[model samples]
Target: MVSTIDSPEYTEDTFISRLLTKVPTPAGEGFAPGDDAAIIELEGVRFLGCADGLIEGVHFDLGTCSPADAGWKSLAVNLSDIAAMGGTPTSALVVLEARLGEADGESAAQAAYEGLGECARSFGVVISGGDVVSADRLALSVTVLGELPAVGEALLRSGARPGDLVCVTGRLGEAAMALATAIPSGTDHPWAERLHRPVPRLEEGRAIAAAGGSAAIDISDGLLLDLSRLCCASGVGARLDTAAVPRPAAAEWQGSGAQRVAPEQLEKAALGGGDDYELCFTIREPLLTRLDELWPEYGADYCVIGEIFEGSGIEGPDGRLDPAGWDHVASGRRSLE
Candidate 1:
């Protein structure tokens, strides 16, 4: 029998309560969602778990985005969450919601699966299980399970200490620009790639873990907002230099270059735009020096953009947090220029 979400009004508040009630909780369940990654102990090892969802208009636009990229992005973002915890993704469960009359839904679905499968194969992750259902629009949700090499070895947002260096993998602002402007068909820019197809730095996460990254977060919600989260979680503050943030071909891309991003508009994209998916982390000064020595192997652009301070708040270039950072509930296409 197909189950229905019945009982009580389906308001957002009650919906959450009813959803939890339906799932049977076994006795001594060690981990659950609502955290960065759920933790469960099995075979004397700590496992990290995470789930992410992408809706039709919210996470993507079918008109401009490729189904393959849509699929890749759905899984990639979840992997990013695992990366934030300093864990390596090992398995996943995919769920798809497809709409009728959407020009070959099965083909789109298959393409989506292909994208997910490609990314999974590249990352050495297994697609253990999944589900499919009909809906008004395309929806994809992925749950990723990962393992930490050792107990208490996972990095978290709460571990940043005062005087630690704030560093980021890869440049910023390109993704935001891609969303703002339309990339012509058959056109390609590394900046647009940053927006459409993000590469989750799993290897870099392992490297950071090995190099002792005390605190870490993936750059999904723009640098300024995400770093603020790190500071708030760690009971600390940070000072970031605007000029130090990496940009795409700063000299050549100033006017009609490959990236097509103006330098003046670069700051907002780096600070307020979302979906960069690179790792932002804090490490001791000593570890930062070590990273500098072995940086070439990682291959991603790593830069020390800020430093953690002993307090509660965040600051950007010129020493004050930008009030215009991206707000999920408040900011959208209407707010951007």
Candidate 2:
């Protein structure tokens, strides 16, 4: 199935049709694409494997984006998902589409690798192996491997229940605004750093795990779109508080190239903007209280943005989370970070 750019086929079948044609699923091996990480048994352990990529002009601009940040984001985004599943990342493989005539392969690759290595070192993950090849544009891909404990539940997009409180770690929309500018050239904005090099909330994931929470996903696809994903997976619906969703500092938006969006518009961007990499999850009201009690120890603010409702898709008290967020097929972007 040749999915056209105009068609923007966002359905699961569009991805499934392409995958099944390539690798036929057998017995219980369900290679569904939307899940954070693919489940494949290895050496009697359930291993989670995930891969992410970035391309020039899609995920980053060739002229503006830094090679180091590009490299770091390519892997850091994947690690975020691994953490969302309450798993500890152990290994990674990187592939680079070497860009010629613009940047030297050795220097460019080294800068990118250095950034990637920095994040990997922080996460205690190893760089195993990867391949380098020539391409017209800068393209980087990283595949991450992680292991989950043998017993108990793996945090998933599904499992959010009605009445469960929706909460998020860290703020949102800062990254979208960061991408709106020319980064690596430096920005006067204080919040800009959060966008260029987002820190994955590995500690928060561990905290949630230790506290016995369920139903979680990394907020790479904006709050609403990601919540839609969780709702779809769990066969439920969500209602979010419009006022509660976090917005970037007023000072950052001032004098920035980004459109002078209104407060609500900025809130919308925060809600729908992708690449925040924060954790969004649902937990029983009881557990929500427990997290509230313990989150002080973690030194982060987790806001109760909404609650699970019966139905499908996500909704804000005001309305549907307007305009939707980024979609690879629809937006002509390379892929969701």
Candidate 3:
């Protein structure tokens, strides 16, 4: 079915619908095509695999961040995908695209690789072999493999029920606010590290798995976009309480930008903005209570922001939420990113 997604013009959703129709890469065993990762078996063990990429002019700008940060984020994005599947990240293969034979390019590429290595070490993932090819600009494509923890089954987006409680981990919209220049974001800025080095909710995902969540996704795209993916997969709908969405405080509205916005409009940033690598999931009342008790141990704040319902669309406090998010197609542009 063609999903208008509240937009008449062609959008990422349109491209995905066409891709699913034309390509039709259905999963032979586990879920595929629409999921963050593919589940495949190796020696009777299931593993989650996914890939993500970042380009110089598309995902980031050197003026705003360093080459090292690019490498870290490139891998972090893939890890978040694995975490969404309720899997433990194991290893990664990186393809670095850079301009060869240039002194500056060589140096930047080394720094980027070093940064990737740092993230790998932090996450206890091994850096498997990969390729480096010459390109016009700096870019990285990473493939990550994650094994299911011995206890819990891998989560899927297509599992939500009508009575599931919609929940999210951590605050949202810092990246959008930073990119909009709605707030300051440089070295020593409040949003600097958050936008660059996002913390993937691996542990929280495991907690969700343990608590028996009905569905889940990583909020890499905006909450509306990603949550809609879960709903579409599960054939359910949602009603979001925007006031319950965890976001910046009123004092955090210290926008340096000249065009001031009302606090109500800013709530859209938390719902519609992207780049917050937190986990959003749906669970039953019992699981919700379990997760509430488990939250403190997971060491991340969470909020119950909505509920799954018997329908095919999303409704918010204001009305239908725009299923908009960071346009990864041109992520470097302020408006798109």
Candidate 4:
């Protein structure tokens, strides 16, 4: 079967589809590879596990991100996956491949470890042991393990049903703006800060799960792509009110580069940009009021920007949006020039 995957121009989606076709599904498991994390029950205790990778060029540019920030992002990305499942992260394993011959290699490596340590301490996550090796470029892979609260259930992407309200946490597009402006260090750029230091909506995820969220996904991919995945998982469709999507403030985009981005393009970036690390979720119609009442305690603002219905794909006020985001294989090919 592996030999049968013969497309020379294969995509990440194609690779994943072929792999899933070969892997055997775990019996009676409610969650599997398609979700943000794998939820498993052992001895009546549920656990969530997920892994994320950060490559030197694909995920960050050394000129733009400090080693510390890179380390923080590597771990934060995995933490967001756990948060999406409504789990509390407990421990992590980090696999680091450091370039040993670079002039700033040692110092950069130390800074990255410092950043990882600080982030782990902030989240109360312990760094279990991991492996390290020499490479031409720096890369970090993080695997996080988390446990669901006793009274709360894990939020699965398949739980959303018809009549559920589509929602999101915090404002979108700031990260996109950050990438667009590429502000220099020490510029006090809020969008740059948002791009480098994304906050995982852990508390909000727990609150949603406790309040009976129908489904949830962390917005690591673009809002549209992630929401589309949730809809597909639940066998439903989404109707988005494009006007209701909470966009970043215009002030956040002020700079020389801001002039290059049209106002309408900002909306496109907000809808399709990746690395927001916010939460996009669904709540059954009956629980919308309770979710609103409990929002203040979660320390984040949420907006209902759409609704779930019986159908096949996502639709917006302007009609259907292409479910596209940052694709590694496709992006890699483009970067070769």
User: lDDT per model, in order?
Assistant: 0.74, 0.73, 0.79, 0.80
Off by over 4 Å in 3: 1-9, 20-29, 182-186, 253-262, 296-298, 328-337
Please report how far candidate 2 places residue 275 from its true position, in Å.
1.0
lDDT of 1 by residue, 83-137 (tens): 7777789999989998755777777777777888888887889999989998877
- What's the residue-level lDDT of 77 in candidate 1? 90
Candidate 3 per-residue lDDT, tens place, 127-191, comes to 88899999889999999998874456778899999988999988887666666663323466555
Ranking by TM-score: 4, 3, 2, 1
Q: Name the runs in model 1 displaced over 4 angstroms.
A: 1-35, 42-44, 100-103, 149-152, 184-186, 250-261, 293-298, 332-336
lDDT of 2 by residue, 51-95 (tens): 888887677764666778788888889989887877778999988
TM-score of 2: 0.87
Q: What is the RMSD, in Å, between candidate 1 and the native fold over all Cα?
A: 6.4
Better of 2 and 3 by lDDT: 3
TM-score between model 4 and native: 0.90
Candidate number of the best TM-score: 4
lDDT of each residue in 18-110, candidate 4, tens digit only: 779898865676755778888766797668889988888878888988888888888988889988988889999999988777768767777
lDDT (C-alpha) at residue 286 in model 4: 81
